[model samples]
Target: MKIMEYMKERFQNLEFIPSIYNQWGIGIHFCLGENIYQLKEKEELNLKRFQVVYEQITIIFNELFEQNDDIFLVTNMYKHKKEKCIRKLKVYQPFLKCKNQKCKNHLNQILVKTYPYPFEINKAEEYEMQQFSLLCKPRDLRVTELLKAASNEDFPLKPKFGGYSTDYPDVFFVNITKDNIFFIYDDRGCEVIALDFKRIRHLYEKYHDWVEEYKCM
Candidate 1:
C-alpha cells in the first residue's frame, strides 16, 4: 500500500479524532485544545494522544519498510517531556534521492513528520527543507550555499527579506551563483561578494540599515 493510504488507515483507527485534516488528505492534525483543558489535564491527555500518534507512525514506518527495506532504515519518534506529547517523527536511510532531486547523491537524508500538538502546521516546503538540513550533511559547497540561503531568508540579495535591485531584475540570479559565492550589488554600484557563510550571514544581519538607507535614496 502507499504511504498516504497506510497513514490514513492508521489515523482512522485512532480513538481520538483529528481536529483538522490537511487539504491534501495525506496529512492529519490533532490539537490538544489547550484553552479548554488545564495544564495538568492537558498533560495527561497529551500523553495518551502521543501514544496513539506514535503507534500510527510506527505502522507507517513498518509499511514503508515492507515496501523497500533498503530505502527506509531508521525510524525515531521524539516527544516533548514537559508537554508529554510527540513532537516529531523521523524516518531516514543512507544515500536516498531527495523528493525534489535537488540532492540525488547525498547520503544520510531524513524525512521528518511533525505533529500539530506542538508545532504549527504551515509552509510544508520550508519544513521539508529544514528536516533535510537536520538529517543530511552538506555534500558540497553548492549544497551548503543553497541550504544556508533557504534557511536564512534575510541573506543578501534575497527578495523575500527586502533585498532587491532594479539593475538585476531577476533576484534568483543575483542571490545564487555558480561559484557558490553570494554576490550583493546595491543601486549605488557598491558590490559585496561573500565567499564565507559566516561573513555573509553577518552581512545579512547588518544589511537592514543599508536597506533603510536605500529606501530613503
Candidate 2:
C-alpha cells in the first residue's frame, strides 16, 4: 500500500490521537529542505497535506537512523503566521565532558570540594566553572562530566532556566529503542506527550520511493 493509504487506514483504526487543548489545537509541522508546511486544526486539518508532511518526515527519520541509531526531531511552533512556521529536524547529542580517566578524576575532586551536598548551577555558573577547571589543569574536562560527578542518576542535572516563547510553544524529541520508538514533547504549559513509534514506522515502510529518488540525484 502507498504511505498515504496506510496512514489513512491507521487514522480510521484510531491508532493516533490529535493534540487538542482547550485553547491551543494540535497540528503536524513539516520541514522539507528549506521550506516548512503545517497542517493545523485551527486552519482545518487537511488529511492529504498531513500525509505528505508525515511521509517526508518518515523518510528523513529512516535515512538518519540508518546512519545513527539515535536522533532527535525538533519542530518549531508558530501561532499567527504560516510563513514563520519553520520546523527543523536534526541529530541531538547530549553534552559529554571528559572521556579520559585522569581528567574525570580531577573533575570529580573539584565537584566534591565545590558542591559537597549536591547543588544545582545555572548555565552561566556552569560555564564559569568549566572555564575555571580548564585554567586549573592540563587534563581536558567537560561541564557534563562535572554535572555527572556531582549528581546521582535518580536526581540528574537539570537546566535552571524555563522554556522560552509564547509564540513557539513546544519542541519534540524522538528516539528509537530496541523494542519500540517513543517521543517526548517539551512545552511552555508543561504539556507533554509520550507515544509509541509504530504508526510512524509503518508509514515510512509503506512509502519510501522518495528515498530512491534522492539517492539517484
Candidate 3:
C-alpha cells in the first residue's frame, strides 16, 4: 500500500530493546519525512502511523497464528469520557460497540458517569485506567477503521507527559505471548517496536539508513 511520497531530511530511528528480557524494537519519527502529504505540522500523525503499523502488526500476527486464528485486542477505555456519559440514560459505548448480540444482551445497559479520581495531588488524574478488548479474527472488525477513528475519539489526549502510564492516548499495544509490538503514534513519529527480535530486524533494516541510535527507554 502506498502512503504519501516524501524525501528523507533527517530521519533518525530509535532502537531500544530490553536485553534482560525478550522484545527488541526500532521506531522512527513521522516528522523525519519531509513534505508528507495530507499531514498537518502541529497535529498528531494518527492515520499515517496506523496505516504502517497496522500492516506490520497484521503480518506479524499472521506469522505467528493462522488464517482462522483469532488475535487478541486490548484497547484502552476512556475513563474520563466514560465518566462524562456514565450517568446519562444511554448505553455505554463498549456495550454498544460490541458486534455480538449475545454478548451485548448479557451486558447490563448502564449509562456512563464520571467520578473524580481520589488521590494525592501528584496523581490527581492518573489512575483511572480501563480497557475494552476482543478476541477475534483480524477481518471481523476491519480493525483499521475501528481503531483509526474510535481509539482517538475514545482517548483523545495523546499523552505527551505523565498521566496514566498504561493509557497511552495515541499508542496501540500488540502482544503475542512474551513478545510484543508497540504502535507509538503520539511520539516523534510513527514507530513500531518488535520486542526481543520477535521479527523486527527486517523492519529495522528496511529503514537502516534512517536509524539513529539506541537509547534506554
Candidate 4:
C-alpha cells in the first residue's frame, strides 16, 4: 500500500477526533488540507486512540525513510540521550537498477531495518519502547546544528530532560523545548529532528505582527 494510504488506514482505525477546544470552543485547526493540530479536553476512549495514531505515524515515518533515499532525515541524539551527542540519520533503498540490460546485474544492498543508536535504550527503559520500534529512525538538520552548539557537560537535564524527537520522519521535529511536544526516538534513544514549531507559530504570529512592522517600515 502507498504510505499515505497506510497512514490513513491506521488513522481511521484509531478513530481519532478533536475532543478538546479553546475557551471560545474551537477544537480543530487545519493547514494545507491537513489536520496539523488538535487539542484534547475530555478523557475518553479517543484519547487512547490519539496515542495509537501517534505511534502509527511514527512507524510509518521510519518506513518512509528506509524506503526512499530522496528523503532526508535528521535528529538530535544528545537531546534525547543527553550528553554532548547528536545524530544525523539517512535512509536508503535496498536495491539499485543496472544500467546495462544485457548484463542483467541486479545489485542489492543490505536493507537497514534499524539504525543502531549509540545509547542502549530498550523496553526496560520505558513503556514507549514496547509499542514502537525505536531503532533505525529518520532525522533532519536543525538537530544537527543544536548538537554542534550545545555544551558537552552533563547536567541535571541530562536524561530526564528535553531531548529530541519529531512527529514525522522526513519533516523536521526537535524536542528542545520547555513545552510538551511530540517526539520519536531511535532504539538507543536519539531524537530524529527538532520540529519546526517555532516557524509554524512565528508564521501564525506574523499575521498579527505584519501591521505593526508595516507601520515601522
**TM-score to true structure, per model:** 0.20, 0.22, 0.44, 0.19
lDDT of 4 by residue, 31-103 (tens): 1102222233662222333333334334323422433223212222222322332222121111112244411
lDDT of 3 by residue, 76-120 (tens): 333443343222111123323356674454233321223344324
Which lDDT values do the candidates have, in the order given? 0.25, 0.26, 0.35, 0.24
Q: By TM-score, who's the top model here?
A: 3
Arranged by TM-score, best first: 3, 2, 1, 4
Off by over 4 Å in 1: 1-45, 67-217
Off by over 4 Å in 3: 1-70, 78-127, 150-171, 209-217
lDDT, residue 162, model 1: 18
Quality of model 2 by C-alpha lDDT: 0.26
* 41-111 per-residue lDDT for model 2 (tens digits): 68653445434433444443343234333323222222222233222211011222345675455334321
lDDT winner among the candidates?
3
For model 3, how big is the CA root-mean-square deviation? 12.1
| Distance from true location, Cα of 59 in model 1, Å | 1.6
> In candidate 1, how many Å is residue 47 off?
1.8
What RMSD does model 2 have?
20.3
Q: What is the model-wide C-alpha lDDT for candidate 1?
A: 0.25
Q: How does candidate 4 score on lDDT?
A: 0.24
Q: Could you tally the backbone clashes for each prediction?
A: 0, 0, 15, 16
Model 1, C-alpha of 89: deviation from truth (Å): 17
